[model samples]
Target: MTKPRTILVLGGARSGKSRHAQALAEAMTPEGCFIATAQAWDDEMRDRIARHQADRDERWTTVEAPLALADAIAEHSRSDRVLLVDCLTLWLTNMLLGEADLAAAGDALVAALEDAPCPVVLVSNEVGFGIVPDNALARRFRDAQGTLNQRLARVCDATDLVVAGLPLRLSGEK
Candidate 1:
C-alpha cells in the first residue's frame, strides 16, 4: 500500500488554494472526506459554504469541524480514503473567537496529521504577505495564522503556495 502523506496548501484569498487542495485529494482517491472549518455566520458566509459544498459530488463525505478540527481528522482518517481540510485560517479564527489556546490547538492539529492513516490536504490563507493590520485583534490573528502555517509546513510532506490560480511547490515532491 502507498504510504500516507500530508500536504499543506497556502495562498491568499481567491488564490485557488481550496480548489487546488481538493484536486490534489481527488487525484489520490476515488472517495474522500472534506473537513470544512467554515461556519456560516451570515448570509454571505452561508452562500460561500454552499458554493463549496456544491463543488464536491457524491464521492465525498462532508464533515464540519469549525473548532474541533483535530478530532475530526483523527476520527475520519482511513487508509483507503483521503481527507481535504479546506482553509485552516477559518479554523484559527474560530479558535481565537472561542478563546481556545492557540498553541495547544496547533499542536493537536499537527499531532493528528502525523498520526493520520490517510493522505491529507490542508488549505490555509497566506496572510502575512499583506500590510500589517491596524487593529490589535487583526494583527494578533495574522501572527497566529503565520505561526500555525509555519508549524503545519514543517510537518507536511509537501507544501504548495498558490498564486493567481497557479500552484508553486514550496517544498517536497509533487
Candidate 2:
C-alpha cells in the first residue's frame, strides 16, 4: 500500500498559509474536502468566516467541524481525495476554552492522519513568535498551540512555514 501524504502548513495570521494549502490540495487531488475548524462566536469572526467561504470556488466541499476534527478526517478522507483543514488555531482555542484535553485531541488527530486513506493538508497559526501574554490562560494557550504545531510537524510528510506570504519548506519535500 502507498503511504498517504500529509502536509502541515504553519504561519502567523494572514500569512497566506490557508491559500497556499488550498492551492496545494487543488493541484494534487481531483476531489477535495475542506474541514473548517472555526466557530464564529462574534460578528467580526462571522465576517472573517464569510470572507474565507467567499474566497473559495464551488469545487470544494466544506465540512464545519469545530471540535471533532479526527472524526471529520476519518469520515471524509479517501484514497482518491484530498483533505485540507483550513485552521487549527481556532480548534485549539475551542478545545482550550472548553477544557478539552489538548494532548488527547492531538494524539487522536495524529492517529487519524496515520490511518487516513488520502492526502491531508493542515493549516495552523504560529503563535510563539509574539510577546508573551501577561495572563495564565493566554500563556497556556500559546504554549499548547506551539506544542501542537511541533507535534504535527514531526508526523507530517511535509511541513512548510509561511512568512509574509512566502513559503519556506522545512521538511519532507523533494
Candidate 3:
C-alpha cells in the first residue's frame, strides 16, 4: 500500500495559503474534508469565519475543531479522503489558551499524520519572520508556533510556502 501524501502549507497573513491549499486539495482528491480550527471569539472573527464558509463549495465536508485536531484528522482521514486543515496557528492558539499540553499535543498530531490512512494538507501561518514582540506571552506564542511549523515541515511529504498568492514548493516535488 502507498503511504498517504502529506503537504504542509505555510505563509504569512493574507499570503494566500488557504486558497492555494484548497485548490491543491480539490485537484488532488475527489473526497475532501475541511478541518477548521478557528473559533469566533468576537464579531470580527465571526464575520471572517462566515466569509470563509461562504467561499467553500458544497462538496467539502467541514469540521469545526479548535482543538483535538489530531483526533479530528484521524477520524476523517481514510484511504480515499483528502483532509485539508485550514490553519494550524489557530489550533495552536486554542491549545495554548486552554492550557493544554503543547508538547504532547504536537507529538500526538505528528504521530497521527504518520498513521493517517489518506492524504493530509496542513495550513499554517508564518509568524516568525517579522519584528520581535514586546510582550512575554506574544513572544512565547511566536516561538512555539515557529517551532511547531518547523517540526511538521520536517515530517511532511511536501512543503510549500505561499507568497503573494503564489505557491513555491519547497520540497517533495517531482
Candidate topping lDDT: 1
User: CA lDDT of each candidate?
Assistant: 0.92, 0.89, 0.89
lDDT of 1: 0.92
Among residues 3 or more apart in sequence or in different chains, the pairs in candidate 3 whose N, CA or C atoms overlap within 3 Å are: none
Better of 1 and 3 by lDDT: 1
Q: Considering every candidate listed, which one attains the maximal TM-score?
A: 1
Each candidate's number of clashing pairs is 0, 0, 0
* Residue 15, candidate 1: C-alpha displacement in angstroms: 0.7
lDDT of 3 at 144: 87
lDDT of 3 by residue, 1-174 (tens): 433289999999999898899888877778789999999999998998888878877888899989989999889887887999988999999999999988899999999999998889999999998899999888989988988998999999989999999999888773
| TM-score (all chains, Cα) for each model | 0.96, 0.95, 0.95
Off by over 4 Å in 1: 1-4
> What would the per-residue lDDT of candidate 1 be over residues 1-174, giving only the tens digit for each residue?
333388999999999988899889998889999999999999999999999889897989999999999999999998899999987999999999999999999999999999998999999999987888899999999999999999999989899999999999998886
* Stretches > 4 Å off in candidate 2: 1-4
